[model samples]
Target chain A: MTENRRYRLTAIAVTLPTLMSATAFEAGASEPGLPQLDIATWPSQLFWLVVLFGVGYLVMAKMVTPRIGAVLEKRRQTLDGDLEKARTASSDAAKTRAEYESDLEKARNNAAEFAKQAAMEATKKAEAADAKVARKLADKVASAEAALAKAKTEALANLNDVAAEAAIDAVAALAGIKTTSSQASKTASSIATKLAKQGAN
Target chain B: MSNSEGMHSPVAQFEIKPLVELSLGGYDVSFTNSSLFMLLAIGVSSIFLISAMRRADMVPGRMQGMAEMIYEFVAEMVRSNVGSEGRPYFPFIFTLFVFLLFGNMLGLIPYSYTFTSQIIVTFAMAAFVFVGVTIIALYKHGLHFFSFFVPAGAPKVLIPFLIVIEVISYFVRPVSLSVRLFANMLAGHTMLKVFAGLAVMISGAGGLAMAGSLLPFVALIGLTGLEVLVAALQAYVFTILTCMYLNDALHLH
Candidate 1:
């Protein structure tokens, strides 16, 4: 295609000068007449037209058009590049946001787990303290009951001895008969044993 | 006074006094005012484009902006009318547009010659376009290009008549194209000159004539502004028609 274009351009370029010369020859041979209507000026006018038009065409095709096309092309490319960059940047931002949200979710899960473990440990410690306080109160109650039982037994024995002595004095005063101390003691002991048995029942 | 007076004739403005008369063989190829303005149009177009594109920045300034607008305008016309196949011919079309545009506008200036106003000049350009398009059609499509004259979906009875009409219209392209530009410029400039002359003749009488000249003077001013618009419009019309012709040549239908 380029070769064809070049060939055509060269052909046109070659023909232009030839055309101009041919017209110039016609102009020289003709007589001057009415400026516009005259056949003489036609050749010259046509000649200059070819020359000037050829010059204009060469400048336009070779120089002006390409530069303008380039400018337009550059603008389009720059716009496309900027749009691509923006798309990539937005995608990157979206990825970063996703990662951040996932990290936050992970941190929240860890915090919940730690709180549950701490609560369990605190409940265990409180239960252990309550058991120790209950055991101490039970031991104190048992010892006090033992001391009360021992004192009751000792008071019962003293009461029986005193009862025997009193019974012997009463018999001497009322009946004028004196009983033996051992026999009085034996009687009092029997009475005391019976009372104790009744209390047990 | 006669010599000075002779210069004021309306028709005299169209005279082609030779600036540098030259000959080759028996040919008289003299450079004249017409040639001077043609060169001026060429020089101005070149300079305008070269300077506008010299910077060639992605962001265009005023001059570059103007140049680009014109470029894009013609480009769009070619693209819409002629399609992508017309790409190769863009430079030629663009050059023709700017040349004619400048030629018309320059003619609007006082004492400046409008080369496009000349029948031969406009005809030359139009003939070039017509011949070039026909050649392109012939080269691209070969002898089948002649089928362009046959109307599609026509009844068998009408085909012959239609073909004849189409061929005549095709041959008339250059004539019509040339006459359109030539006649518009010629008529507009001539009208402006006549109106200005009327104003001048009326004012030259002094006294009451000077007061009476006001209407013609105003009309002259209005006509001058209208001429400028017509000049630009005619150039646009010429270029667009050329593009349409190129399209028909390339695409057939």
Candidate 2:
């Protein structure tokens, strides 16, 4: 619709000059309304206006516009790069967190297992030490008992010899007896009985 | 001529005549008020900005702050439309916006010429934009820039007609663009001047009619405010169109 309006407008504007021309020829026509196109007079002005516009345009489009577009493009790239970096960093951090958590769990489990093993080994060593000490003590006690038994046997033999000597002396001194076998036998019996009585007393 | 001469009254009785007329090689060169003001506009703009920028500090004073604000405003405009890709063109766009803004504002000063009021000046600027965009489109797209004349999804059989319409529209770009800024400035300023003149004339009559003059006085105040808005709008329109042209050059769409 706008395009059609513009077209109609253009047609009217173009036909205007021609219509004015005919109207002019019909009028007094003393003064020419439109001046003849004088290339020398006005085209120079138009030319310079164009030249100025061109220079201005070049400055804007070539120099100015491109710089602005560049800044925008650079900004876009920077933002994109920053976003990617953030994403990668986040993913890396997540992976590291997961690895650390798993390693920590593994370390805790290993520590618990090691502690249990150490405790069991300590208990076994303690038990072995107790058994060795008990064996040594039993051996010493048995040796001490054997020594006591030997000492007792020697003491008894000494006591019997002393008793027999004393009896022989007493008989010989009391009866002026000869050292005869029968006398000796009787004396031995008496002595044996006396010794038994003494032992009893 | 009678209509124009009669229209000159109710404003200033003063008229500008060429002073120090010198026809240099058959070109009528005269230092008229218009020429003087054109030079004055250039000088004033240069002096103010240069002086303001002279003692530019990281922390700005009033003058520097104003200058910086102008720079920032134009910079933001370029940034928004052209995107960061358009940063380098900041100077041209900035200059165009500033010159037009200053010209429009300066005319609002008592007894100052409005250069933008003249079609020639406005058209010159628009022509510059039109030519610049064309060159840019061509340079960027090469022969492919011609493809801009063809609309997308346009049927093949209708191609020729669309091309003609496109060409005409393209040619009209500068005319419409230039006239919009020029016509708005001229019309608004002229209306203000006429109303103010009426207010002065009516109050001079000095009666109940003079009491009635306060209405125009109030309207003048209102119009002044509107003119400021229009001035800014004109500058904005000029800058945005430049951006749009730049957009076409870059995108070829």
Candidate 3:
């Protein structure tokens, strides 16, 4: 719409000047054989200017301006496209960098966690194995101690029985050497006493 | 003629008189020498560039190479200032630059009218730029385009005053812009003509004065070269200013 207005304006400008010249020529009336104009007026010049301006403006607006505008628009579009492409590329790079950094952070945290868990598990296994070996040693020591006590008790009982049997055998041998009952008794008593005394001594 | 004929003075001849007498209506609309040269400049540039571009190849011929160079130059200029967004303005700016450059150069031809020497013509061109740039600004920013005059960091107390100043500045742009080109071209050409006229007068006086005439002749030649550079420079300045205005329209700065 604005372009159309300009077309009209240009046509008027051109035609107005044409009319002005026409008026000038008419006024130079003294020249013989000169071509003449039928009308001469300010209003007419104004009208002609409008007409010319309109025609010129339309021609320029329709034909000349468009071609120039198209070329300009193409250049503008190319620049805009470049800027947009740069912006997208920059954002994509930033996104990739953020993703990489986060992934690296997660990987690091996982490694640390796994190490701590593995160390805890190893400590628990070591402590269990130590407890198990200590309990086995305690059991073996208790059994050995019990066997020693039993051997000591059996040795003492054996000593007591052998001493009693020796004494009985000595008494029997003294009796087999005989006499009168009283005499034998007395002698035996005496021998027994003596033996007793020797034993005592 | 004689040294007393001041009309022959290079500076005096640039005095402007409107070619067509302003009136309400007439049937005598026709091209004057100024209009003829103006059309010629546009035609020459268009023909050269369009024909040169017809057989564009990877390895360009001379004409194609020159055309490509111009395209590249303007494209780069737009790209740097207006950025890629301003690429659309390259064709307009390029056409404007070539047309003005050719017009300025062609006016130096003997008996040719210097269109740029006339304030009205230069002002007309400048006004067109001003109007076009304003339209672009309004199209891009709508009514909010007025905010450009406020600036971003200015103190609030100064807003009303600053807006007025900015508006004034905006309106005065075409005047200043037109005068810059018109003044430069007019000054350079007038000086050259005056110096050449001196050389003619001095040589006519004869004897030792003829040797003095060589000085103005030499000065004229040197000034002619300088004028060529100035011509190209003015075209460049004009083109760059247009781009800057477009940039302002696009970015509102």
Best by TM-score: 1
Model 1, DockQ value?
0.24
Q: Tell me how each candidate scores on DockQ against the true complex.
A: 0.24, 0.05, 0.01
**Which of the CAPRI classes, incorrect, acceptable, medium or high, describes model 1?**
acceptable
Query: What's each prediction's TM-score?
Result: 0.77, 0.59, 0.54
Where does the lowest 10-residue lDDT sum fall in candidate 3 chain A? A32-41
lDDT for each residue of candidate 2 in A45-139, tens digit (9 for 90 to 100): 33333344444445444543344335445656878999999999999999999999999999999999999999999999999999999999999
lDDT of 1: 0.79
Q: Looking at candidate 3, what is the lDDT of residue A89?
A: 100
Ranking by DockQ: 1, 2, 3
Where model 3 places Cα greater than 4 Å from the true spot, the runs are: A1-201, B1-7, B11-24
Error of 2 at B101 (Å): 0.9
Chain B TM-score in each of the candidates: 0.95, 0.88, 0.88
How badly does each model clash, as a count of residue pairs? Answer: 6, 4, 27
Candidate 3: what's its TM-score on chain B? 0.88
- For lDDT, the strongest prediction is 1
Candidate 1 wrong stretches, greater than 4 Å:
A1-34, A86-102, A105-113, A120-201, B1-9
Predict model 3's lDDT versus the native: 0.66
**Per-residue alpha-carbon lDDT of candidate 3 for residues B141-214, written as tens digits (9 for 90 to 100):** 99999998886788999989999999999888887787788777766776787788788888988898899999
